[model samples]
Target: MPYAPSTVNQEQSRANEGPEAVRAAVGRARDAAPAWDALGHRERGARLLRWRRVMARRMDEIVALLESEAGKVRADALVELAAAFEHLGWAARHAGPVLRRRTVRSGPLMFHQRSTVEYRPYGVVGVIGPWNYPVHTPLGSVSYALAAGNAVVLKPSEHTPGTGRWLAETFAEAVPDMPVLGVVTGDGGTGAALCGAGVDKVAFTGSPGTGARVLAACAPSLTPVLLELGGKDALVVAGDADVEAAVEAALWGGCANAGQSCAGIERVYVAEGVYERFLDRITLRAPEITGGPGGDYGRMTVPAQLDVVRRHIDDALARGARAVVGGPGSVVPPYVTGPVVLADVPEDADAVREETFGPVLVVNRVRDAEEGVARANASAYGLGGAVFARRGGVRLAREMRTGMVSVNDALAFTAVGALPFGGRGRSGFGRIHGADGLREFAAPQAVTRRRFAPPLAIQTFARGPRDLARFERLLRRRGY
Candidate 1:
């Protein structure tokens, strides 16, 4: 469906947000960058603290908008909102230390000099957010960017534009004078414009195809980008594991956010010993799901996504797969897509191979833990995975070719606050959360101060023969 520009309400989005407005916003941010960066970390953190308080007070409003736009449940929407607050708090408290200069010891001959590295904020950051978990994902970039002293131009997903508006309005309440952070709303064109808007960097969260486009637009200007793309994450259940626990973990991991999460579990390889048991439990729980207004499940946010879900189901059924919960034509009232559990699915089916960002979970049996791990790793995405091995859960988690792995729980790494969240290969590169997130928006500057000139003065143009002899002796002592 084409996005009708007339339906876009400027008041609901923001005043002055057309192409010309976006250019102006970028210009304003660029002009404000030096002043914002000049504010030491402590001063910048005060603004973030005010924003955090605003988020806490108005969380219900945020959650309601999230549900209406993204078609998520109230509880799930709150989960997203709460995580955003926590992330903001973490960024505010830690950005100072993480970005502060730290002295590094200079060895021997250069010992008289003190070396340190300081992190400098990028001039301006362009953010492109997605519809799924709109607040949580975008705040990861926005909070870090702000804490690191970069002005931000955020372009939220077209599907959930209202949520973005709400966030921008809330922040405005806290920071009234400085338009340091501004929001732009539109279809892909606006995003393309932002990518080429001459911002120092761009942070985008979306599908692989769109991620590619964002990168291509940045190439001409040599602009840097952080792309958090798609994932076909897998779950491995080893033999002798707690079958019930594994099934529950898989259900939440696969169906949470209607399976729209980049880290949502899409595939499962179960060891032969517990395959049937796990399937039975998941089948029992899956059908009880309902989607609609005030329902457990919600319709896919993007209308085009429904077709993708249907196609994956059709491909599996045509290949002789049995649906333990929902069939191809299954539907519910309102916004719910309903939950689906497919068992005995062929490994090669589209449902197993591609990312069905819907309430669908595929289960296949494997010979052993090694086989399960092998099957889980056989994907183009390595964003997040899960393992339910009794004896070697940590070991198995370490072996998964993804950035994050939950041993007994599902998607718990995101809550840890200290663990870095990112992915490998097709899931995209770079990280958010923990110390890495603070560094993402800042550039490193190495500093060195010479307390006194060395007696030999080897760095000068007047280096003598005695310095060369001393350097050779040092290298020989170090076994070089």
Candidate 2:
């Protein structure tokens, strides 16, 4: 018997659709794009609202699928699903205003012209989603793409293909006739095919290595790609921080979803003044949070990730780092690994420099907030981080070189719909949330119209030496 019979059947059916399935799906999306685009932003938003309602109605089902397929605990799955719903609502409610055409003031030389900019969809977007937060992450691309009036062809992680199919089916109920969204279930090969399948753009959320591969595959066709990749996020605790609150944020930000999240906190820097107190609080609270087949944090979804976690811990310990909570014996089985916390870990240790992507936290002490921010900004990965400071929260947060930072909380920046979520360097580029996200799926088109005949015409053959002199005078006066 299959683990998830419905999901397995759906996958099997999609597989039977053959080698050309990705191409076929892209073709269908292409055929559907014009009509969908013609519906305009408001109409597309209405359809997204309908889809959001359907998803809300099937919240339990979605959560169950998320748990079974992604190995997420009940609470974690609920959080992911809730985030997806929130993105859907935000995309639906704001797409119109965000994508609306905006008029701009004309230059003095072209005073008789009216200038405006419009956002147009890219027609089709190919999205490759990750197993961690399978629903929420991909929907970050899907919701915005749909709102921008582009059809989507999503290839979910093989570990959680079922959840992807379920989402596509739910979306179908909202727009039954149009092929606005299509799910192609397969492994990396399918994802590669989707990228090479002539889609206008590709939105991928996965490891940086995989993101590089996606970039390579899309290169042949010159397809635009938006990548949301891995991170080795840090959490800094200042001397004036609330130790209790910082401890809570550390635990949740580090261990939630079995530490499978790309934005999960993997390293921590605590000021010398409050280092011992922070460690005491974390050591006391770490044990309260458990990980197993059935525990506060569920088993690691991808089996291979367990070895990566084990290797990082071993490397940390081999370099004289002490395990404050969990250590070598923390590995429980084929999929589960308990949370591990280390102190005095070397700067060059695998756990500190690399993305463990596990329920592990390396706590390092710093002389002060200056040192904390400096150390946090040293890493190549800068997706997300948190700064817990009573007096200089925002200032310290600004000092850290990450995409998103929470002043007093952990991962709170992700919950806000208006803030753009993405990173620099190896954490990947191109945003996925907010106004930037909506604009990511669309292309900007500038429109300029002649409001009246200008005394000094410059754009046409009607332009003469007098017109050129007038343009230069205007440029000089405007400081151009």
Candidate 3:
């Protein structure tokens, strides 16, 4: 059994489920798959809405869970639950229309056939989730997969197993018929078991390194996988941008949730003209934003993450970057660090190239928005980014290579339930939280029915050269 690392009650540790737990959970999910799929979209959606109501009534309980299991602040916990609620509601309400069968024209070449395309549940879906934003991240896959009529067995991060179990149990209250959603909790072994447990599809969210491992685990079975991995997102501050708005965007986008958000702002590219002004506001503002169990943001969720953040900030400093907000001794003893802001970080430095995944922000001065856009696109990770500009914000945003970009705002793409959320390159592939998300768990099924007999009869082997000549002449008549 694995246990969550605790900030309090250090003497007591909570034991999590083992690898066998995941295998059994997947077996139960597979068994319930048929009944779950037969519910159809409308009925499934209704049941999901009921689950949403149950989740809403237990929001406070969920918030407390986040604080304990994930070391999340109450404020950030609420935000996480709220986003999860949004995705659940959207999936419940829209799965019907999004996954229903659709008529498709066969075109003139196949005029005799009536064609249609539809989506069918893949039966059992295995979801491997992350610890950051524990509720919101896993629910993105669980809710959507459920709404699309698939029974799901989730292997949530061992760090936040209790929180993940709460979601599964509460969902049961809304839908008690069968185990529509099941949770398996442990370390990587449990997750690996789920990937090879004969699931039709697997949706995983985590680092590229872990994602690669998950990919390799599922390779023997050739199970279809959907990966929502990490990101080193960037923020571009234009010279003509509203300085105050940009500052707020950077502060909230970069530091909120302890900067643990996968799509959150990790780096900033500010235009030379207003670089000092932006830095001035940030330097003064950051020291005021406190953390560690009683402040603006939450403490570091994972203790090991502290080392990564320290290493990045230290590397940036060693590379000649200056910290206007927090310098050395920034990483608190046990589990706390950032809203640290480093200025003039080199483009190729570790802090710039890698995903620090802490509240630290690397701000570098650029010639203009164009250069900022170019620098932002240079990262190996292209999950999400933001640009602030008055004249050409959209154009600049479009120029970046990220999957999602916010113009004159910060991480706005996540708030909109309709937009697909995923990325390219090292950030991983596939999506969650949109029409695309609903379909990701379901397989496309195309149906063809012969509507009439064709005059040419070209498909028959009995046809001779006369039949071929006749078909050729008809094709010529049709301007083929």
Candidate 4:
């Protein structure tokens, strides 16, 4: 067995399940899929609700594990846990209706046919989760897959196997008879094994480089994948925006989670009018939000990522950028980088173009909201963005090329269950929330029933050329 040591304390570690463990989990999931699906949406949902109850009853225990393993603050861990728990409730409460069969419109050509489409769960879904949000992110896919009546084999990030084990154990306690939710915990090799284990689908959350490897692993099997890769999300501040609110949102959104969030605010684009004010306010407030034990945020969960944070800040500084609050010295010896705010950073700088998953923010001045939107959309990432404005926030948000945009706030879309979360470009594709998330692990099976005999037997060999001609003439007459 491999080991998953705590980022906060390396001595504290848990024995990790290996690739063999992943294969066994998948085997169990394969065995359980049929009966699990046969239970129907209502019953599966009921079982999921039971699992949710189990999680709720043991919330404090999970939160403590999250704190020690993932280096997440108590409050941050609670919010993450709450969001995931509530999302599970939403999936269970709505799965039946959302995945239920429903009539679809039949066009004029198919007027004599009755059409319907419904979602059917893939037998088993393999989920590869990131450590930053071991509970919430994995559950986002796992809960939906279970609610849709599919068994799941989860391979949580190796750094947080304890949290993953907690999820799998508690779920087993909820429904001990069938292994509807199976877990495998290990490093990269274990995840690769899960990807190629012949699961019905693979839902992954991680960096783009790793996502590509996952895609490659699933390619030979022709297994479908849903990726929620991280993003270099932006926070756009309009001239008419409330500077106070924008600054506050930036401070929280940029520094929260030690900036490990995929949709966190990595950069800020402010219209020229309020650029100075926003910059001044955010700079003065950035240093106040520190990261350490029992601080505003917790330590960096992954110690290796500390280099990336320092690199982005140093790169920007060396390239004529100025630091408002922190600089090269900000990233402390071990695993803590407070808040580092940079201004006048070049457009091509890594801090602006790439994902610096740390407590850092890049605030740049734009000509106006139009320019802000353009600048924000110029990046290869389009996972999420924020628009802070009194008047035209919604309009600018619509124009911004991202999957989810928050108006007048930051990451508000994250807390909303109805919103589908994912993005374009390097941010990866596929949604994992709301109707789309439930549908991601399932395939749409459409049925068409013949209502009566058609005017022309064009679909069958019985139809002659004259019948085809008649059909063509009818189609042309109707301009279809």
| Model 3: how far residue 389 lies from native, Å | 0.5
lDDT of 2 by residue, 192-253 (tens): 88888899999999999999999999998899999999999999999999999999998889
- Total backbone collisions, model 1: 2
Residue 472 in candidate 2 has what lDDT?
94
Which residue pairs come into collision in candidate 3?
Answer: none
Candidate 1 per-residue lDDT over residues 1-480, each given as its tens digit: 212123346455634356777888899988877887888899888888898898789876777677667777887887887788888888888898999989988887688899999899988999999999889999899999999999999999988777777777777888876777888888888899898777899999988899999999999999999988889888899997888999888888988887788899888889999898888888887767666666675667887777788889889989988888887756433333567878888989999888888878888889987898898888888899999978989988888999999998789988766677888878888788878988999999998899997876678878888888987887899876
**TM-score of each candidate?**
0.95, 0.96, 0.95, 0.95
lDDT, model 2, position 397:
91
Question: Largest TM-score belongs to which candidate?
Answer: 2
Candidate 4 local lDDT, 317-410, one digit each (tens): 9999999888888889555557888999999999988899998899999999999899989999889999999998889999999999999999
Ranking by lDDT: 2, 4, 3, 1
What stretches of model 2 exceed 4 Å from their correct place?
1-19, 335-337, 470-478
Residue-level lDDT tens digits of model 3 in 1-480: 223223223222224556676678788888898898888888988999999899898777778778877788889988887788889999999998998999898987788999998889998999988989888998899999999899998877888877777788787888999787987767888788888778889999999999999999989999999999989999999999998899889888888888899999989999999999999988887888877858888778898988998999889989999988876577895455558899989988899999988888999999999999889888889999999989899899899898899998898888678889999999999989899999998899999999899767789898889999988988999998
Worst 10 residues of 2 by lDDT: 1-10
